[model samples]
Target: MAAAVLAGAAGSAYVVTVVDRPKPVVVSHVAEVLDGETIEVRDGDRVTRFKLVNVDAPAASECLHQESAVKLAELLPEGTPITVVRDGPFVAVSTQDGTLVNAALIAAGLAVPSVNGTMFLDRAKEAHHSAAEQRKGLHSPDIPCTLPGQVRAITEAAAAVEAQPLKGTKTELTVAADTAKTAIGLVDQLAKPGGLTWDAVAPVDQTVLLAKVTKVVPTLYRKEAELRNVVKGLR
Candidate 1:
């Protein structure tokens, strides 16, 4: 009975030592804004580049890249004091006012949540979902360069093509085929990797956009196919 009590006491002590220890953190000041999801912080004479965990912003040449970088600059301008907790290769940065910079980017819709095995991943995901729903920043439908706006454009184009009658005279059939071809080209452009119109759209919006395109594109294919066959017969 004494041995059992001693064993239990040892286990409790081990738990307290391991789980209750404070994590190491870096105290620093922002030296420069690298991009939306990266920053350089100076700790005395040491300067370190910190990439925010669990968020991915648009790359250079992508839609909203400038806007995202501007937002991060606004949040953490040069010389802003910050606290950083290292999580593997990335860090969770917080302003003195208690704002989590990583989650802030996601909430503002400038960045999407990415898995990095960080402790704050769930918070980042929640912020991302809210931003997408609110249509903030990159998710805004008002911006012509954004993914949502492009999807809307494609949807409208497809609708216009579908409205035209598939059965018509040779001239009308030829025009219909031409219109459908244009709409299909837009879809293909959006889906293609490394294309001019391609952007790293958020996964949530991507799922919704995929469903919409899947429903609309097949009808367009049928219309174009029928029109081409009729036009060929007329020729």
Candidate 2:
């Protein structure tokens, strides 16, 4: 973890926190395509599996899973060299043909956005929304997509936090922080095994973060109101 303090032109102090993350391990050459979002690759002499980050495709038994797999196969055929990068608990892929595989999959409507946080969250959301609007792939009129297990848990956690009392005091801030931390733990626990399937958890992580943003808004407003009252009294 890294921290820095900055002073603005107006003499306001801001504390910035940064987390140092290791570079993702890039694996070259695809050995196999397990499904829509999972792949096997050659990492030196050993073969390992890497999950695609920030996208969740249908499971084998679910509707459109085969279609999703077929689409992926078309995009990345056998022996097609590709690059895989593992970022923290998630993995991302880039095809030899210059395809940002995660974003591509979402755009094609082959998968929905995962609940976990991703660097490409905005792009993925736009793609998912477009696909949904057009009734593409798994988002077809007859075939609705189901929220992954982890996504469901995080959504519920966000709802629970939103339902809490907002007293707009230091106590409320403490409560909100604790609740948000608990939600993070719950999300971590919900992550599935296999690096590729891990992308399934990103969507809800993003959701929980947004919920926290909403929760903090009231506290900020309360503080601003108190400050205004003090200024008025002085005047």
Candidate 3:
């Protein structure tokens, strides 16, 4: 649990707040997909940010960024109104099979955990750690960016951090910091624009973190055109 918390603090894990909205259909509208795991849901013209659970997709410049998005569309189509529910502070939706596939994305190397699990959401962090250890690939902020093939990204990242001096070499620290930041950013990018598989958010064990997605407007979500231009700068 301590390791998991540290991992989360260093951007290795995502923290999600459960939304206790008891009344169903409290918010309504169409949602737009931003990347693999993030989506913007329109509720009477209000844009709400939703983080997809389980899965993690690459960022705009990451090797699989667009590919993940395309695959997500293939798996989940736009205009598909899924059951949307409030899971803590986040808005959650259920997958077609309703197995909390959002977290599965991280397991599948498609996305990373977005936030650390709070007291109300610690289970999420534990689940993520278990999943990360299981995959052995897909490095998180706990480690540097690595492939699922490596199967040692976490240990390797941990080693890297251990060897670096916290107050010594600025150059070394910069390198270490960038590597970690990249890993964390990758995770966040995937979490957003993430939603239920445009299917349903239902009672998946009645857990607060695992809310079902009811319905949503389907549309491919790219960043605002203006922000997209900023991405070009990164390239």
Candidate 4:
């Protein structure tokens, strides 16, 4: 019975030792950048691909895709040493200077927060929120290719159209009717799914919509002026 107890105690000690062992530090150098959120790293003779946890960048066909990739390249230059930690299916990468690359991308607005099993996810989400609020990178209104920028342009055009003064003369009424008809058509187009009012309008389509609004606003103003003139004549 004493031998059995000793054997059990020894087995428990062995299990505790194994469980308490620290994980090895993984050190690798950047070999190639796949995109804003993925990179290939070289560790001696082995090269492995790693996706940045808690961040998702624009795809190749999306707006700001190239810019996002360029920013990532700047952050992690070729041969730059990086520390990597596995977080579920993804990995968290940090620079030699201790800058978290995943959070950096989000803070720059080049990437959005992604659902990941990592302790850094909340920090990354905070960075993303700040970037969006500041209108940095892909969220900037100065960038005509971005969705927010396009939406601003469309909203401005609509405001211009609505700013025209209403007139009450007969000739002006006729012109106003024509202008109103055109404006109504434009509004109908904008009311459709994926249109200017939608959250997913394409930049090209937004440009076309802006042009239509710009072209009609002048006519609307002219019609309103003519209608006022007719009213004056009658008075």
Candidate 5:
């Protein structure tokens, strides 16, 4: 399932398959970074490995090697539950606020952007930018703007009350139904053996009937529980 990446406060819409009924969830601790692409997290005895999707960083043997790892390490702390987009075997890592960190790294010339399973760009640019002024090379360049720290972490409280999916909404549904011309005959008549099918609206008034159906309803409901969750930062 795809997880929505929040690019900014506006957020981006992404569709993920719903495998089960949606439930509120949270986590507390993370284990360690196995590599630039993989991280191991511990939930008590249940250790889960998350493979970062959409991008890859340099192997330790590469030029930036230690520098890149150090940067990722600095951004993360021990036991920080990284909120990730869990898709099957891999967890796509977005930023603490859902910004695309790996892409940002590539954009800032810190790491090469891997595409189609191969590193498309060479270290020519990365080396030039990261070669800190050690003369002997002891400097690490300051990170650029728009890199997300903590990668991403959904706080114990709700990040924001997610708008609940639209369901059982009569007004909106009625408007939708009214706009479409479909025969809505009696259930019994439709089910009859030799079906006595007839137009339910024998004398349909296009305008009057449309107005009588309903008004526009919102996308979702805001319950008190959801409000509390928003304040608590748990959605």
Candidate 6:
């Protein structure tokens, strides 16, 4: 057994319970701000780098990345006390005052919930929705980032495909193929009759609309692959 001592009021002592193991994880002090979702921490003489869990911030070159980084820095400047919990390759960070850095980032619209997040995944998503509703940070209409409109449209189409019997069922492969076709049809309908011209949309909406095509195309192609597999398996 190992006893860990935590800082407290001058006359008070706080004993932390720690099991004796070959290697132990220790709470570290924030040493440097790496970016919106990454930081360097120091524990005694050892320094380590970790990415905050449950949130995915935009890249440095992407819109709103600098703003996101600034927000995080304001929340956790160097020497701030923080605790970290290992989550796979990354770590979840929380302030000594019990503020969750991950949730804070999402709630402020500085980051989105990671698709592969483990702990507090649903909470992060909820915070993201709240941020969007409030038009905070990058979710603001004037932020000039890719909007979620096309993302929502693609999500609806993907959900429609999932509603069908794509997986194991009594339904025939032809039915699955038809469902995939329907999903792709939804994507086609997103394009206006005028050929989705750049000049047609407002300047602000142009980047969002054009950028989403790359994102939506991959989802359509995945459904197309499923259709091809259904045809091949029918033989």
Q: lDDT winner among the candidates?
A: 1
Best by TM-score: 1
- What would the per-residue lDDT of candidate 2 be over residues 1-235, giving only the tens digit for each residue? 3221211122111111112344334565678888988888887788988777777888876656888888877777777776655544676666654466776777777887875645555556766776656655654434333233334444555565565554445555455545555556554443433432333334554466446544554544444444344434542
- TM-scores for candidates 1 onward, in order: 0.68, 0.49, 0.39, 0.61, 0.38, 0.53
Angstrom error of the Cα, residue 178, model 1: value is 8.8
Write the residue-wise lDDT of candidate 1 on 37-104 in tens digits. 88898999999888888878888977778888999999899989877766679877777655677777
- For model 3, residues 1-235, the per-residue Cα lDDT tens digits are 2121112322233333224435334335336677777776666768777765434457675544665676555444565444455445554453433323354444444555555333323444454456455543333222333332111332344345445555544455556655544433433443443332201111232122221111000100111222233334542
Alpha-carbon deviation at 181 in model 3, angstroms: 27
Order the numbered candidates by TM-score, best leading: 1, 4, 6, 2, 3, 5
Task: Give Cα distance to truth, residue 175, candidate 1, Å.
Answer: 12
Q: Over 4 Å off in model 6, which ranges?
A: 1-26, 146-235
lDDT (Cα) of model 2: 0.57
Report lDDT (CA) for all predictions.
Answer: 0.71, 0.57, 0.42, 0.62, 0.35, 0.62
RMSD of each: 10.0, 18.8, 19.1, 13.5, 26.8, 16.9
After superposition, candidate 1 runs with Cα above 4 Å error? 1-28, 159-182, 193-207, 214-235
- Model 2 poorest ten-residue lDDT run: 6-15
lDDT tens readout by residue for model 5, 1-235: 3223223222221222223422212334557766655667776788887655444555654444455565555444567655454434444444344334343344333344333322212221233233222211112212211111100111101122123222425443333333221212211122331210011111232233223222111101223233333434432
Rank all candidate structures by their lDDT, best first, as comma-separated numbers: 1, 4, 6, 2, 3, 5
TM value for model 1: 0.68
- CA lDDT, candidate 1, residue 185: 80
Each model's number of backbone clashes?
Answer: 0, 12, 61, 0, 10, 0
lDDT digits (tens) for residues 1-235 of candidate 4: 1010001122101000111213313666899999989899999999988888887788876667888898889989999997776666787777766567777777787887778755467667767666766777766767765655654554454454355445444554555545555554544544553421222333575576556655555655555455555555664
**Least accurate stretch of 10 residues (summed lDDT) in model 5?**
148-157
